[model samples]
Target: MAKQYSRPSHYEQLMKKLQNDFPGSEPITGLMLIYLKHIVHVVETSSDMIVKIVEDLHNMEQEETSCVAKSKILIISHDIHTRLYQQWSSRTLDIVEHGIEAFDTNETFENLIVDLLTQLLKLAVFLMKQPKLNLKNAMDALHEKVPDLLPQQSVVHYLLEENDSSMSTPSEFLTLYQRPFDTSLESDMVWPIPTRLFPYN
Candidate 1:
C-alpha cells in the first residue's frame, strides 16, 4: 500500500500567527521602516558625493585639471540629485510622518541628517588631503534648504569650526551613530498621516 500523504497545515497556522501579531499596523510600519532606511542611505550617499567634490578641488594641481574635476563633480552632483528625488518621492507620507513622531519630533531625525553630512565632510578632508571645501557654506546651504536638519544640542554646530580650533576630527560625527531604531513604533494607531515633507512644496 502507498504511504498516505498528509496535507501541510503548518504554513496555515504560521500565517494565522503572523496576522495576529501584526494586527492592523504591521504593513504600514514595515513599509515605513523600509523607506526610512532608503532615505538615510540616499543622504549618506549624497554627502559622500560632496566629499568627492571637495577631494577633486584639492587634487587639482593645475587649472585645466581643476576644471575637469569640477566638471566631474557637477555631473556627479546632478546624478545624486536625480537619485535623491526619485527615492524621496517613492516614500509615502505615512512612513515619514510616523517616523517624525516616533523620533519624538524633537531632533532625532535632524541629528541623523547632520551626522551623515559631518562624516562626508571628514571624508572630503582625507580624500582631498586638505580643507578645500567650505564646511560652513555647505552647512549653511543645507540648513537653508532643509531647516533644522541638526539638533540644537548636536555636534553639527561646532564640528567643523569650534571656539578653540578651526577643524575637528571625524570622531565628532561618529557620535551620531546609534543602533537601529524601532520600526513598529505605534502599533495601535491606524490613521492616515498628513503631508510630511512635500518635495514639491
Candidate 2:
C-alpha cells in the first residue's frame, strides 16, 4: 500500500494567515499579491535546487568521483536549469501580455505591471546563472546589467510628473464609457466673407 501525503500543518496555517491578511478587495491589488507569492515560491524553490546541485558538484570534485557519477550530476543540473528557464520564459510572456492589455486601457495598472515585470525578469536572470557559473561573479555582472532591463528615469519619471488634467480615475473611466458622446465639437460653423471687390474700367 502507498502512503498518502498531506501538507504540513504549519504550511496550511501560514497560507490561511496570508489569505486573511490579503483578501481580494481590489482586482489589481489581489493580482499583485498573487504574483508576489508565485515569484517568491519560484525563487526559494530554485535556490534550494541550485544549492543542492552545487553541493553535489563539490562533493563529486572532492571525491574524484567516476565519470558516470559526474555525468549523472551534470544531467540533473542541466534538467533543473532547463526547467527554471522555461518557467521564467512562460512567466515573462504572461506578464508581458497582461501588461500590454493594461497598457492599452489602464494607465495606473500598467505602471504596476511594468514594475512587477522588471523585478521578475531580474530575479529570473539571477537564477539562470546559478547552475553553471560562479555565484558572486554572476551576481556582480547581473547588478551591472540590471539597468539595461529597467526603464530609464526619463521615460517612467516623465509619465509620473506630467500633469494631464484629462487623465481618468477608475470610476471616471467606467462612467465615461457608459455616458454618450457630446458631439458638440462636430457642429458646423459659418465664416464671414471678404468685402474687397475689384472695379474694372
Candidate 3:
C-alpha cells in the first residue's frame, strides 16, 4: 500500500517514519515516486511488514496527526524471491512540478500515476541491463554524460537548477518535498507489474 503524496513536509515525516520503523537491515525494500500530490509506491517486503506499514499509514491519516496521507495500493508482484532494491528509499519527482500541466491534457490523475509508475519501472530495468554502467541515480543520470541512458522527449522531465551545487530549488530537488532528490534509484531485475492502481489489481 502507498499513501497519497502529501506536503513535502508530511512526506518527509513519512519517509523518516519508514526509515525508523523499518531499519536498513529489514528485508523490506521498494521505490517511492512522489508525483506531485500522489505517491506511487512499490514495496517489496514480507507480508507481515506490509500489513504493519499499511496499518501505520492508516493511523497517520486518521489520527489527525501532523501528516495527512492515505494509500490506495496496487500489488505489483507478490510471493517473489528476489528484491529489486537493497534498501528502502524514495524519489520525489513532481515532473509536472505544479501538478497542473499533466492534467492540461485529457487524462485523469490516476492515468498519470500509472504512466509514471510504468515508465519508471521500465527505466529501472533498462538501467539494470546496461553493461559496465553504474547508473545509481536516474535524476542525476538525466544531466550526466549518458545521452543513451534516457530517451528524447522523456515523460519524466526533471529540470536542474542553474547552480549545480544548489539543492535549494524546489523543481530540481525531488529529494525533499522541498532538494533536487534525497537518494538515488536502483533495481536488480524485472518483475510482473499490476496495470491498475487499485487493490483489485
On lDDT, the leading prediction is: 3
lDDT of 3 at 23: 81
**Each model's lDDT:** 0.29, 0.33, 0.47
lDDT of 1 at 90: 16
RMSD, one per candidate, in order? 25.6, 23.5, 17.2
Model 3: lowest-lDDT 10 consecutive positions: 158-167
Q: On a 0 to 1 TM-score scale, where does candidate 3 land against the true structure? A: 0.48
Q: Estimate each model's TM-score.
A: 0.17, 0.22, 0.48
> Whole-model lDDT for model 3 versus the true structure?
0.47
lDDT of 3 by residue, 82-198 (tens): 565654556555344343323244554455446655665665565455553454555344424333432222232221101223122222222232244555434323255335556
Task: Point out where model 3 deviates above 4 Å.
Answer: 1-26, 97-120, 130-133, 139-201
Residue 5 in candidate 1 has what lDDT?
A: 18
- Better structure of 2 and 3 per lDDT: 3
Clashes by residue pair, model 3? 2-71, 3-70, 172-180, 173-179, 173-180, 174-180, 175-180, 175-181, 175-182
Q: Is candidate 1 or candidate 3 better by lDDT?
A: 3
Q: Which residue pairs collide in model 1, if any?
A: none
In candidate 1, what are the lDDT values of residues 1-201, reduced to their tens digit? Answer: 001111123223433454465566221110001122121112223333334323333344234423221111101133422221111111211222222322323444346444655654443333233233643344334434333432222232222222222322222222222335556656335467455565764
Report the C-alpha lDDT of model 2 over 14-90, residue by residue, as the tens digit: 33444455565211110011121011112222323334323433343345332212111101112332332322111
